[model samples]
Target: MIRLYTKNAVLLAVVAAASYELAAEFGPWPALLTCAAAAAAASAAGAFLLRTSGVGRVTWRNRLAGYLIPWGWRLNRGKLWPIPVVSWAVWTAVCGAAVLLRPAPDQPALGTRAALLAAWVIDAAALVYLLGTLARATPGGRVGPIWKLVAVIAGVISASVGLYVGGQTTAALVVGGGPPVVVGGGFGLLLLFVVTVGRNTRWN
Candidate 1:
């Protein structure tokens, strides 16, 4: 289960990186569309691969749940700073990429792509690591698989949008002069974060 979660996290991280890269090339809206299409394609390919790999026919719902970091809120309530830390780390990486990958005056080149991708991978790993850590620390009060899957799917989308907004905003502010309309996605991302933490935190 841990391995599965890690793999999915890695994949999502790749998705985030790729989406941001696309955003750098195209604009945010078009980059988002391309990401959606890519996600659909990747999901289809994943389904087919799982079906044929003798790994047992895992439903898409379960697969998505597997990708999410399970929140053992009750078990780890006292040590919850890590979640925010993970999120902060992601933002920090974005900041670094913005400055480090800032395009030149002539035209955007390929030199910064590798650095951005590396930063994205670190961001993804931080998220997955936090989830894995919490799951390992706590073994109780888990949400239902269906709910978990739903929460994670929404969270991933929100995260991706947030990343796009951050990446684009940084590029615009520091490097290029892109749009600053990240409020829609930023608000959604914050809301989802609250939802995930609040819903998973066991009060009993």
Candidate 2:
């Protein structure tokens, strides 16, 4: 049960974070808040699952989690931080959504796309922070520079998403406005490359 809870926490956190980012990019405040709420709920569920279960009857993840850690590290192995962290993420995501829902004045005015872009950037950053917290909380959290490097790269992705979103909204006056969807999508794809190939680089 503990193992399951751990795995569930890790899984829910990462997915929720990613979902928040994607939803922000697409727009619609209700959807973003819902995604954030689900993530927070999942984290709590994981905690509950942990509290009730014994180690012997726990999951395979518990067994493997230690192995994933470095030679001298240990996972926190509880519901406290994970649940609260997730809750905060959801809270922030909801705030971003609220800000987004305020109704943009117009494209040319100091509203509309600006609010939308701000929401996306904040949402993306929140998710990245959530993911980083989860990564650092894991059994391997204390070990390698790999996690730090990966975290840095994830930060870059957030920045890229923000820049892309801003560029998308302001493209009309910027000489050439490539579609934001295309640019954002491309940036996301590039992240996949780094996560796949660079996550294990010498620096990490």
Tens digits of per-residue lDDT for model 1 on 27-49?
A: 66576665555444544443444
Q: Where in model 1 is the C-alpha error above 4 Å?
A: 1-26, 55-117, 138-204
TM-score for each of the candidates? 0.33, 0.35
Candidate 2: tens digits of C-alpha lDDT, residues 123-184: 34434545555555747455455556556545544554455346444532221122335566
Q: What residue pairs are clashing in model 1?
A: none
Kindly provide the TM-score of model 2 when superposed on the true structure, using C-alpha atoms. 0.35
| Candidate 2 Cα errors over 4 Å, as ranges | 1-27, 59-80, 83-155, 168-204
Superposed Cα RMSD, model 2: 11.4
